[model samples]
Target: MKTLVIIVASLFAGVVLSAPTDSTTKDSQENTYSIKVSDHGVEKEDTIIIDEEKNIEIFQTVDSDDAEVVEDFDAGLEGIIPRNGDSCYVKPLNSGENIPPAELKSRLESSGSENVIQEQGDKDDDLYVLAGGPIKNRAVVGETIAEKCEGRNIYWLTLAEDGHQDQGRVKRSCYLYYCSLRVYLGKGRYYYHCYIVRYLC
Candidate 1:
């Protein structure tokens, strides 16, 4: 009987010692986000989990088709940009000349308007104009300029014939268009229009 008791006690102690601690169990738990994407005849799904710091911990993918399309979920713009074609021709702008940075600053300063400033992105490929004036007046001018260049892309306060902006906006009270273009060149022969715009405040 004493031997049986000792054996049971040893088994219980072993179980307790092997049990996972609270911290270990919590660390094993993960927060996951899932999404299903289906287009045409292809269906794919992804399950991503993050750690305590909100960083991706595990990226699990399950696909219906046995094909190697699981990686497509992480491939952005993989199938978007054309892979082949003749390069697109971009036409010249009939209006708005490319103004130098110094010239742009000079024009803004000569306006004799207080609080006149020019802002550009880190790449310095685009510019935005801010003038201290009534909001109503600025809106009117911005609307007019936007209308005139309705189908065109603007960059650095100049107008371009082609290209697209990630964000388009005219200054609050001035006719300022802040535009940025991102071009992706691939091995395939493809034609695209690239344009930049410059607007004076």
Candidate 2:
């Protein structure tokens, strides 16, 4: 069954750190969102460009030691695009109400997640897949963990390019976590990867 729905419209706006020395132009889409940058000491307005998939293109540039990195959308959270210089990643999840907790329960194993993708031979770049079942609160489950891994507190594991995340500092706590269920549909056999993240309480 297909579980992913791609939104093909412009949805957000963001600041690009240092617009390349070459040029800075506004997109045809006329939707711009503003954000307050505490560090830059200035409020910047962002331009939003919607693609065919409705995935928001937030124009933000991160300055790396080697070069300037341009990011289209928020890498950590959807709906809210990150300001330039903000260190984070946002990946859009499959959004809808059809995903039920029961379906989530059937998909995940209690002890360990499946199709674990490991980390590359580096400390910073890594990825993995986390899975778990339904939670007591259906509302929370609807947000992140969706119906794919329903019936238990939301849980997830890290998936890196090479394989499962396994290294120093980048431990299980760093990758695997429990939070309000957030769901996203991917391009292959597996449609969902549940991540239950909890910030400082």
Candidate 3:
């Protein structure tokens, strides 16, 4: 009886060891795997198939909202005009004259209350004069003036090329003021001498 049992155990062990390994039967088997991925708050599911030759094929399914296309829009400087009841003034730009801050403050105060500085041009319009030579950072100065005096019809006057070419005018102007008009004065070969004038609302 013992000999028979040992023979049976030996046969069972041989059969288990000789059984086909997973790799040997892999070609006859097919596997399906599901994978999930999330990106930018969107979740997606993918299915993979392993064929007999161990080649993988993938298919993906995504929600309609996740695949949607979006567009961006930008509106620059549109509808930025000052509202009603806002006062406007032209801050003068004097070339080569360094007016003290105290003087400027006093001038602004006097002008605000008494309107000491008369309008340069037509009563209905405002005129700013840029009298001297070419100014440095003309664009930057114009932008600053425009921001300070809003809701006003502004004008800019700069010396023409003829005046800038004259050598006798030893005084060089820097940082002159210009109007708030959205006019594009091409920065000519010479520095621009411009003025910014603001009309009262």
Which candidate gets the maximum lDDT versus the true structure?
2
Where is model 3 poorest over a 10-residue stretch in terms of lDDT? 7-16
- Best-performing candidate as measured by TM-score: 2
Weakest 10 consecutive residues of candidate 1 by summed lDDT: 7-16
TM-score leaderboard ranking: 2, 1, 3
Angstrom error at residue 65, model 2: 8.7
Query: What are the lDDT scores of the predictions, listed in order?
Result: 0.23, 0.25, 0.24
- Residue-wise C-alpha lDDT for candidate 3, range 67-143, written one tens digit per residue: 11100011011111223323222233332332222332223223221111111221111223333332333333334
Worst 10 residues of 2 by lDDT: 1-10
User: RMSDs, each prediction?
Assistant: 30.0, 20.3, 39.6
**Model 2 lDDT, residue 27, Cα:** 32
TM-scores, one per candidate: 0.18, 0.20, 0.17
Q: Candidate 1 lDDT, tens digit per residue, 5-26?
A: 1110000000001111222244
Ranking by lDDT: 2, 3, 1
> How well does candidate 3 score on lDDT at residue 21?
22
